[model samples]
Target: MLSPKKIRHRKTFKGRMKGVANRGATLEFGDYGIKVLTCGWITSRQIEAARVAMTRHVKRGGKVWIRIFPDKPITKKAQETRMGKGKGSVEYWVAVVRPGRILFELGGADDELSMGALSRAVAKLPLPCRIVKREEL
Candidate 1:
């Protein structure tokens, strides 16, 4: 049996999650894939530019996933330590994506190339980003 405190804590967490879930609307979804335009902390102008670049490839018929990390206040010490200028502060993770590779794995009509496609798409993005890990799903 769960303690009273634990039950209360779980309810509170669920309530918070429910509130956040209600704020956003699902922009797009499909049987084959989905491209969601979510809220992020960076400037909308910057985010839109990246979206436009990715959209071009999607229009050509490929699965693409996009997510924008919300902006947060940065400390001066940390700001100076980063690789880029003050702008490259850790708080600014503009966008992250996991472009699908079903086509490549199946050897479809187009050349199925996951790494190449992901790299090319990421190259056009504004912020510094990389593919950290890969996992089977």
Candidate 2:
């Protein structure tokens, strides 16, 4: 699992996802990319799993860039616990993703290879995504 080395605050208020991604919406680092199509919380473990799948599929033929990082800490209460003891302990880290966000980028590989690797990565993610190319950006 991926987590911040240091956190200024352990608990934070729940924020709203109100708009589409404005920045990092285009493929900048690679010729092919995976663009997220839904809004959701992407866990750190899921990101690592996707990365491993892509790396194994690429087999050193390309470079992959992970655009999102799990920085937000989510809290959860213990089962059978009372409901009034503040919020809850931080349970895990997640990246809040919105529609139109480019989650991963692949470079140095041919179209077929990149697409295959990206598709494998997509299976590890929790939300729906699309494989895109630089020209499509």
Candidate 3:
């Protein structure tokens, strides 16, 4: 379980995700994962790194949770197109970054690129967010 402060940080850091799903895929909680607690914005390149790492360990499976503020605003044409005008209400996102695959459990953003919170959240996780092979698990 995450501490409340960490949970809050996670919400603040999840600003860059798309939206949320009740229970989507079998890969809900990644086999290997990182839970982040943040407040500021992150970059695409950083997210890409985590994604790349996750991909390398695809067999093991991994997920990155980024938490952010709920009422913060997002200003991107792409976001408007994907999430509409009244979105961005949630507080975090779950991004699974794999080399050949990047799965995003968006909280309240538009496109995956805008998910800075996801990137930051991934950075905060204690362990490296690399997906290991089934053999390791």
Among the numbered candidates, top TM-score falls to: 2
Residue lDDT tens for model 1, 1-137:
11122222111110111112232123232222122223222333444454455455445555554433322232233633756553332222222222221111111113334344444454544434443223325
Instruction: Estimate the overall C-alpha local distance difference test score of candidate 2.
Output: 0.93
lDDT of 3 at 122: 51
List of clashing residue pairs for candidate 2:
none
Query: Tens digit of lDDT per residue, candidate 3, span 76-110?
Result: 34443665564345432333322222133332232
Candidate 2 or 1, higher lDDT: 2
lDDT of each: 0.33, 0.93, 0.34
Q: Candidate 3 at 5: error in angstroms?
A: 34
Q: Which ten-residue region of model 3 has the weakest summed lDDT? A: 66-75
Tens digits of lDDT, candidate 2, 4-118: 9998998988898878999889988999889999899999999999999999999989999999999999999988999896998989899999999999999999988999999
| Ordered list by TM-score, greatest first | 2, 1, 3
| TM-score list, all predictions | 0.31, 0.93, 0.26
